[model samples]
Target: MKPFLTGHEELIHDIKYDFYGKHLATVSSDQHIKVFDLDSTTSSWILNDSWKAHDSSILRVSWAHPEFSSSKILASCSFDRTVKIWQEQPDELHGSGRRWSKLVTLAIESYAPIYDVVFAPNHLGLKLGCVGSDGIFRIYESVEPSDLSQWALTSEIPILNSSLPAKSLQSSFAIEWCPSKFTTTEKFIVVALDQGFIYGTKPGGGKDDLQNSPRQQSPLQQQLEQQPQSQQESRYIKLGNLPEHNGLIRSVSWAPSMGRNYHLIATACKDGYVRIFKAIETAKGDLKIEILAKLNDHKSEVWRVNWNMTGTILSSAGDDGNLRLWKCNYLNEWKCMSVINTSNRSDNRGIEVEPK
Candidate 1:
């Protein structure tokens, strides 16, 4: 792997690549976002743009599919309790230069520090979902695909289960949408809470109305209901929680279905293990989730997990400064294919040597 100095003063929190992988975006605790462009000629990453995006630490950044709009867009969530949308535009002053500009800012009513933000697939239109310290999951939709500024709060649902205590909720959570290519109208999102429980939900349906359920509604949901009828019709219906983890969950990723009848989800937790789940659809269209595998190769807390574009391989990072890759065999059992040590070694003179 090649490394590039990002010039970030604080620790970097998250990094995301565009749908085509031509561009990369990284967010840092220094409240900055940097974009990089891959130079096809030299096969090296070049710094494209860098800017301070928030007053507080920016935790996560996500890139929207280019098919949703004419230009590329990015969404970022920060500890300042705001999620900002950015768009790439041609620089009028400098010829052949591109610049990223802020398009819109979404502030939650609870004012809790946002943890994660992700954009839905291209087929879902211009929709974004976010989760935060407030234990509320929010979905925002762009009414006009041509205008990114025209966004509406479509759904807001509490992520905590009815049996879980309010104090059990943590300040960090991760969420990802199922990338099933078969269904166009149906959408499913998997959420992992730092309190060790993962939940799935299907938001917005014909009979799912929130007008009469004010007691269970979030502040943002109640506020959205006072808007025009067309804007308040969306609601979130809970699908139920998954098997509990022994420790806090750090990240969750849903693999691309790619015409498959079943969906795969991977989760990394503080227990130094990675768990994979298989969600299959029954003949009647009901979804069922079952534990597929428990991988205990990591010796430290697993921090992040993600799948490749084809969803054939799984990658994970951990606090031990190591990266591990996993793949399935003919028997459908996931095995660790390789391990990369990220920690640097120091010589007798105390000079640090990079891993080769």
Candidate 2:
């Protein structure tokens, strides 16, 4: 936990480590993205690459592919009501094969900024989702274009469920995909909401192209609209109450386990605590969830909690400028592994600014 770099005008919204934990990526509201090498001996790792990514404060940065191996795609969400995709063109951008540059830009409703973006884990063919100020969740595809900055909307989920009020709780701050089920029958992505909702959804399709969109045709008068009956559309499965945090649950992440009964999910919150929950089987033979542990050592709002690729190691940072690492014991309870105190400086996770 040495001082990696100093003197930035904004908060660090996010920090992502490569799968092998050998590299690090940090995004700050200063409108700057920095990539660092964990094995650098000179304290200052080479500035692999950077750019003036967003028009406003950048809220989040995510690696759209698996670490080290195939992480050429980078996704960023910002307060400027847009989501942008970047590519790491090794041979062209950086001589060493680790440079990332802007690839695409998605303009959504004005002021409806994007907060989070993440590619589906263990997924093939390249796709990712971004959710932010507008309370809308959009899916983007990695289509190879003559201009890499070009991307298309593969699917757009304006709402996760029909049951929940569409406009009531659209501002989703956290989202995560369930671990690869191996069985294709149950493909789902979990979205954590600010209004105490944790639900799942399967990719249905796209609504309309947000990038390079085409004009629509109103041919309803010719076909009578082929009026159809109202069919039940139920792609989302509701888990249960996850109010372990007193206020809004800020972030949620899962462990890397396949067995249904061997899964764990952790959440950080404005309540200033990180809670771990494991799946439980009920007497009715239904799968349920139980709280494994609650780490309240973070003295300020716990902005985020993320698991390492192994899911055994956890890292969390907050408004207090404290970054902590927690390790799970045999008892399933997690203990503090390491702590990074960047106090006296406002944490990046908190200083994010999103448009209305």
- TM-scores for all candidates: the values are 0.83, 0.70
lDDT of each candidate versus the true structure = 0.73, 0.60
CA RMSD of each candidate after superposition: 6.4, 9.2
Q: What's the TM for model 2?
A: 0.70
Candidate 2 per-residue C-alpha lDDT over 1-356 given as tens digits, one digit per residue, 9 for 90 to 100: 44556334788878776555666677888887766665457545545665667788887777755531344666777878787777766666542434676666775643566778876653333456777655556655444423445455544445434443345553446667655443222223334454434444322322221121211321122232242312112433344545555676788887776454456778887778888877653443234667888888988888778887667788887876778999978885679977765654435543324344
TM-score of 1: 0.83
Q: Highest TM-score among the candidates is held by which one? A: 1
Model 2 is weakest, by summed lDDT over 10 consecutive residues, at: 206-215
Runs of candidate 1 with Cα error greater than 4 angstroms are: 92-98, 161-170, 190-234, 283-285, 345-356
Q: In lDDT terms, which candidate is top?
A: 1
Clashing pairs in 1: none
Residue 165 deviation, candidate 2, in Å?
A: 13
